[model samples]
Target: MTQRLRFRTSIVLSCFVATNALAHEGHDHPHEAASAPQQMVATAAGPEANSFVADGVTYQWKHRPDLGLQPEAMVAAAKPGLHNNADEDPETGEVVTVVANYGLVKLDQQMKSWSLVDDQDPHFAGGMNSHGMDCFTIDGEVYYASASTNTQEVVVSKRGKVIARLESPKGTEFDNPGVNAYYKSGGRFVPCDVVWVPTAKRLLVVTGYSNGDFAISARRVDGAWKWDGVAFGGRIQQGGPFLTGHGIELKITEDGIETVQIASRGHGRLYGFTPNGAMINLNATEGQYYAQLHNAARPCNLDFQGDLTFVPLLDSLPSTNGVAPVMVLKNFESTGSLIPAEFDDLQFMRHMHGLKTVRRDRKLFAITLSWRNGGENGQGKLNDGQIAIFEAVATQ
Candidate 1:
């Protein structure tokens, strides 16, 4: 379901989960909750048919958002209209995705137990110590994750069922030699995005680097999955070549992929790529296809649907010389394909979280966070995450 788009326009670790969420890495500081037995963390809750356990707390499910979310926790990421039931033929090009990695919530929940990569089932495990950042599903085979000592893997399951006992991959595809960027950097990959391309018949994983590098890789789906190699560039300004060069936003296109890379503080650019090959053009704003889409040091979220793009940008109002802060850059660009008239009535949401688009439906959705609380923590006040939907209109 195109995971990356669910994340607001971007991500950068130097700065950067849920119960469903494991603890931060490097720092073994456990959550404020009472310590419990290792295996007890995988608790169970409400309805026997549909339930989830996190950090020793069981959450029951009856009716809520179709995705089953608690009211207070924020909606970290989302993707609308993903029918991941992908079926293609070797002799025929009749493949389509009816399934995808839909909405995901990174809760601060701890795992009842975790196994190091080297110690877990070699054929089945991601190799134990793989920092399991986030979780996703294809056809209902819910599984846990941890990256290999380096950035690698992609474990899938039999469609529609989660086996209580873990099973090694019936087969696996190893990523290219690139993308070994974040081995264990305090659980920053929780918000990372993924793409399963039908044409390429591979899964593209997008992860960040604290050292100013954004790594991406393509894994072949034919027989034994193998990666092409890592391709990286971009980093945070904390002494890196590019300013907030950390690329948090990633999107895959028929020709390649598109992303937003922060170069310097409060500055950014749109990038295009050809799969795991190479960046099609550095900061493609130079190309006639786009104008320089910049941002403030503070990034909100950016989105794309066909050529009609939208970004809930936070920029200074200009009256304070960027010193006191001014306005938000909520932008829309109509690709020559969509009729501008269709979007004339389209409304935009500012101060939002997850933002993603389903190209086939041309529908875009994002989780909205209000500014009422000053964006702070601790208070009866809440960051009630809300979903906003939009239909794109371009200059077709």
Candidate 2:
């Protein structure tokens, strides 16, 4: 059954929503109650069938429910979904995820145990770690890029072995790469997300909200990682960058130009730009498309499969018709509008942040992650979060 979601908008005054969330990278917290793992496969004819319809397609979402835990303590774990990546394990040939605080973890088939391969590398010597991480393979060797909020930098490792730690230029207190001259002052790096471009051999990053929110680029220079340029964003005072540059991904257009799609969480809009910081209109509209479409769902990390786009919301608000922890956008390259026919979720959960798709045996699956205590763990709960897997298929 396809449902139509009414468009609604929710706006926050300050970009300080991320201030308190910067402390969990080093502390040890309590875990959630444990339960037995459930079946991992999805079926079409069983009575346990749970599904939803969107854009003429039927998706049967099955919860591969488990007590998300750290491999060592076996305690319930919560993770800040600052960034996410899903790919096959080179050693075991199974699915794995590069989690924020947990490091590289293999998603077990039986759901009985999760194996942690590498612990996260704290970017600074003694700085507190925050959330955000991504994994990629180069020359058959796995590499991980982790965002350290407290340190305001990124730590790059080779299969868990520390390789590089990226920060602002030496002697500069703030990460003012100086790419744009308009914003005279720069703030803390407070990196939130990072994506590695395999073809170009470079990195694209998005920073936190508070004085951070800048979209910057990085690459290897003279055998060391250095800031290459800025794509967009700066302190909010500049009046031109972004409200909050949170999650970012690379998209290659049909015309052969590679564009960076950024999640401006504070403004509830997705902005696109070229490597040199030229804005690419997501929707071909007379005025700014983002100004017209304000998605209050608080779009977080983005995952793309061909023409289909999956985004998890950091806000608990439901869509026009019902709850949508995750929303799908079809033909995003051509149109960025949230039409009734193009927009549509799992039910009854709040603040999901990570989403990735995997294919096995010709079946498509979506893996999503939720935050612990739904953000700003006031009670100091452990970083365990809810992980859900859904099987999507075309009905037409």
Worst 10 residues of 2 by lDDT: 39-48
Q: After superposition, how far is residue 298 of candidate 2 from its true place, in Å?
A: 0.8
lDDT of 1 by residue, 110-222 (tens): 11111111222333311222122213333333233222222233333222121222211221212322223232222243213334443444444433223323444444334
The residue ranges of model 2 lying beyond 4 angstroms of the native Cα positions read 1-55, 66-102, 108-113, 118-130, 137-140, 170-186, 235-237, 254-256, 289-294, 318-324, 332-349, 374-384, 393-396
lDDT of 2: 0.50
Which TM-score value belongs to model 2? 0.68
- lDDT value, residue 348 of candidate 2: 27
Best by TM-score: 2
- Model 1 segments more than 4 A misplaced: 1-191, 197-199, 218-228, 234-266, 282-291, 295-302, 313-350, 358-375, 379-382, 390-396
Candidate 1 Cα RMSD (Å): 16.9
